[model samples]
Target: MGSLLSVFSGLFGSKERRILILGLDGAGKTTILYRLQVSEVVTTIP
Candidate 1:
């Protein structure tokens, strides 16, 4: 229905945001991404 379409649009109408993460090798970039994907707390050292 039109109302259902409007509600779905309202829920999903937000603009997309892009993020760029840059770091050198062994800088825990992958570790940080993994933690973010899993919603975990990560303790990392350089």
Candidate 2:
């Protein structure tokens, strides 16, 4: 399935774009992902 960001981007423009999230462990990658999917902040464990 496409990511939430991709879905939104498709609605705004024609050219497809991609994203890369780079961070060390426990840098809140999963937390950010959940926020993008749900549009809210959620508790996450590292």
Candidate 3:
């Protein structure tokens, strides 16, 4: 519930790698989330 960038960086920095993707209906939330998940997973694997 704060700066998403800060949270993301913190998680990434700590190797926690938690992700939260959210958006309202008709906002392409699911699609974006799916892509983001794939990207994150890909990036995280080295």
Best by lDDT: 2
Candidate 3 whole-model C-alpha lDDT, 0 to 1: 0.60
Pairs clashing within candidate 3: none
Which pairs, if any, clash in model 1?
Answer: none
Best by TM-score: 2
Whole-model Cα lDDT per candidate?
0.82, 0.84, 0.60
Q: Which stretches of candidate 2 lie over 4 Å from their true place?
A: 1-11
| lDDT (Cα, tens digit) per residue for candidate 3, span 4-44 | 88888886785655567676756665666657667642212
Higher-scoring candidate on lDDT, 2 or 3: 2
Order of all candidates by lDDT, from best down to worst?
A: 2, 1, 3
Pairs of colliding residues, candidate 2: none
lDDT of 2 by residue, 20-45 (tens): 99999988888888898899989976
Model 3, total clashes: 0
